[model samples]
Target: MNHLKVLALSAGALTLVPGLALAHGSMRPSHGGVVQMSGEIMVELVTKPKALEIYVTEEDEPIPAADFDGTLIVTAPGGAKTRSALKAVSGNKFVSSGRPGSGSKVVVSLIEKKSSAKTFASFTMK
Candidate 1:
């Protein structure tokens, strides 16, 4: 009877392991920037003086650079809008040539090259 009880306890513990693994995701900014999730992917935006860099990943796995076309739209506080085309630089990172200023509204869109499926994330610059 004790052996059967121990086996039951072990099976219950094993069930929790996979559930914990599925909860894994990184909200800690890897690049010292803002991080947000669009569906299952994490989008990290790093703003520089002259450019904007977006890093995309799914559960910490790098999404292929050649798989998508991306764009960034920046809307200023005064309602001016600027759009930049992002090109993949390296390792799941897409970069465009404009600095969306502080408090500005920014929208990022990535369209899959093969399926044309779209994914979007919106952020307000800080």
Candidate 2:
């Protein structure tokens, strides 16, 4: 019947919504780090020997590091948590001192200065 056809069409359209939502950009990490997609924004976390790096991008383009205020929360394997402020280092990079140990979990939260929008990315160190 026509009613059944309409319902089927509506269901099909709903399935495509998610795909369209993710069409804004690729989720791959461009900075040799782990990447997470927060809505249309992409956040990448790079762990170094003595520092942590955070990168933010939207629509596959880097968002200026100066536009955000960020914080890094690292939970060690033994359950100790350390919090550090992320400072803008360059174009789209934010850095914080102290490297997270293996088996540690890192969470970076960034707040946009102009809109106050928050983007979060989580990573588990190997």
Each candidate: how many clashes? 0, 0
TM-score of 2: 0.79
Which digits, one per residue and each the tens of the lDDT, describe model 1 over residues 52-126?
888888878889866889988888999999877898998898888777788999999899999998888899988
* Residue 53 local lDDT, model 1: 85
Q: What is candidate 2's lDDT per residue for 1-126, written digit by digit as tens? A: 999999999999998776644378888889799888887778888878888888899988999999999999999999999988999999999998788899999898888999998888888988
lDDT of each: 0.86, 0.88
Candidate 1: C-alpha lDDT: 0.86
Against the true structure, whose lDDT is highest? 2
- C-alpha positional error of residue 8 in candidate 1 after TM-score superposition, expressed in Å: 13
Model 2, residue pairs in steric clash: none
What TM-score does each of the candidates earn? Answer: 0.79, 0.79
Tell me the RMSD of model 1 versus the true structure.
3.4
